[model samples]
Target: MSGTAELAIDAAFAARLFDELAARTGDAPGITRAAYGEGEQIAHDMMIREAQALGLTHRIDPAGNLYLTYEGRDPALKPWVVGSHLDSVPHGGNFDGAAGVIAGLCAVRALIEAGLRPRRSITVMAIRAEESNWFPLSYLGSRAALGLLPAESLSTPRSDTGLSLRAHMSRLGLDPARVGVGQVHLDPAELHGFIELHIEQGPVLEAAQVPVGFVTGIAGSFRYRAARILGEWGHSGAVPRGHRHDAVFALADLITALDRLWGEVLEGGESATITFGEIGTDPALHGFSKVPGEAGFCLDVRSPSPACLERIHAGLLHIVAGIEAARGVRFNLGARSGSAPARLDEALRARLAAVAEGCGAGFTELASGAGHDTAVFANAGVPAALVFLRNQNGSHNPDEAMEMADFAVGADILARLLARDDND
Candidate 1:
């Protein structure tokens, strides 16, 4: 138990937690743990039960963020906080955010089983509402905990329920009044460091046949969730091609323009991704015989470079203007929301790589194209690091296939990192 090879993770415990989560929150195609909803509450309650069983002290913040701490021998040192969000997208795979919290819990369990106490306490945080699909805001729970969430954000409505964030918090018996006042539950200066373990959510590690990855940085994003195009509805057979003002055609033009712009950006030695995730015509207002007069869509753009984001945004505006003038349509893009790109802690990343090597875990250094709560922590100057475990079939879907063995490797690295006494 003293050597790196002997350190072990409680995989059985992790498995039970995962199984229970999927069983309780199971939707049709996959699992659904909506942020600040019933499913997410089930996951949080499960974690609380497990923490109590592990003899850990637990606390819940006003924003409904849960923290479970395993005390160390020393009281003066800043504790290491390890975890990710518990909420998932609609019909999303179970392992996306849950893996990080389970990994943290397993790491602490390993130390306790080995009869070793580190100098700094270890706290596993189960963050609320990381999925922007539920709420339009990015990194909602993390930003609120850090006191960086704007007061106006409290009035933003949840997409599904159409309830304001403040109202939702009240439903959960949480203190939204305190949350709106910019109260800080987690101060950056008081933390030793933050570590988040998540599924790769892409094909990088899977294609490379690697078990894990230490992220160098995370991409920032700008999203318009309630964008719409408006035109006049007319008879399909009666309206001439030139005289028609079709919203569907206008949307198509916009998509095509953005795709071309995305390619140009890539060709110019810039990295960026643009996605139109949701697009459709209103079922209640439209008919097969009539030209569609309105369409709603969502736009998401991400890049690690701030300049790239701005350039694409400008391109988008230009495209919108051209389409409006030509198609005789009006574009109404609702309130814009986004997050800044984050550069993780290089020193902590190096230390993790060393630990991975020492533990015989295969790892590679890469940049994350997907957004994560780790970005929030790093941008807040918390010395954060994101560890990605290899998975198949991508993420945010029903087919996310993360092997238990790969999870163990990532958990082992976390355990070893937290078990060490010396702080670099």
Candidate 2:
């Protein structure tokens, strides 16, 4: 272990805490800590206990974000915050959200053990409701913390229990109305920078044999919720190929066109990804004997470059138009949900790179395919960055392998970065 790791991170403690939380929340498939549910609440309570044990003062923000604060020499200075969420997707791995929070806590623990005080406070926060699986929202806690999400989003009904997020909060004894408006607990202006350490959640680092990686930016994405194709219902066998306006066939053509568009996007030397996560015909109208009258699907497109995203989107629209004319079907690409790309602070990246080098930790720079809470802060002009720890078996599933050594190295890097008073 390097000086930072030795002084700042308690690797054993972090590992133990991870195991304890996993055991408490683990189920047959994987860990289950639904947002605002029993598991999430238990995880939060455990975090509070740990913070108290470390002699740190903790508070719950109006948005239900838990912040454990290690006071610094100047309490009024904007805090350098580091943390990740505690809630998990259904059947998610133990380390997905938990590792980041534990890493932040361990980093702070190391600093306290070393009896070091920086110019600004360091806060470790375990954010809530990062996974959209529970509710129809992503980054709810972070966005609400920043006052970026609308108040109406709080009242949006969850898919599982058919209760609004507000109702769920009420069940947890939190005021939903108060939670929607951010800045009640901590001002966004009071944040110096944000650092989130998360499992790679992909095979990139493992394949490259790197222990850690720095995120360049978060991918911007476009989502179509009700993309549909309308055609006349007819017999599957009796309808002639030329006479039938088959919706399913039109959907297939659209997918093929999108794939061609994807090829063109690659030819332009821009990275882009498109997914048709859902495709279905109306069950009442769709049968083995009938030609499908209507089809519905969801399209998700993402890219690190806004230009590339728009380029692909334009291609999609063009394909829809062409398909509609060729197949005699009406294509309805419904309302889109869009988020612009967020680039990490270059200065902060430089600092992290230097710190990682000093710690002798092997690292590489990459852009995150998945979105994170860091993007919300970074988009709002805050200095925000992500550090990805190596993991196997991917994330949002069981058997997510995050070795303690790798976890310690990541914590060491973050601790050293936070320990710096160079800019202050």
Candidate 2: tens digits of C-alpha lDDT, residues 1-424: 2234447577889988998988999876888998988889999999999999999999886668899999988898889989999998888899998888999888888888887777789999899899876775667888877777778788777767888998988888787777666444556677899999999988999999989999999998888867889999988788899998889989999898898888888888888788898899987767888989899998888899998998888888888888888889998887777677889998899899998888778999998988788888898778898999999889988889988999998998888887777756
| lDDT tens digits, residue span 1-424, model 1 | 2444456897888999999999999997999998899999999999999899989999999999999999988867898999999999999999999999999999998888888778899999999999988888899999988998889889988889999999999999999889989999999999999999999988999888999999999999999988999998999999999998899999999999999999999999988899999999999999999999999999999999999999999999999999999999999998788889999999999999999998778889999999999999898889999999999989999898999999999999999998887673
Model 1 vs truth, CA RMSD: 1.4
TM of each candidate vs. truth = 0.97, 0.93
lDDT of each: 0.92, 0.86
Locate the minimum summed-lDDT window of 10 residues in model 1. 1-10
As a whole number from 0 to 100, the lDDT of residue 309 in candidate 2 is 90
Q: How accurate is candidate 1 locally (lDDT)?
A: 0.92
True-structure RMSD, every candidate: 1.4, 2.3
How big is the positional error of residue 164 in model 2, measured in Å on the Cα after superposition? 1.3
Could you give me the TM-score of model 1 versus the true structure?
A: 0.97
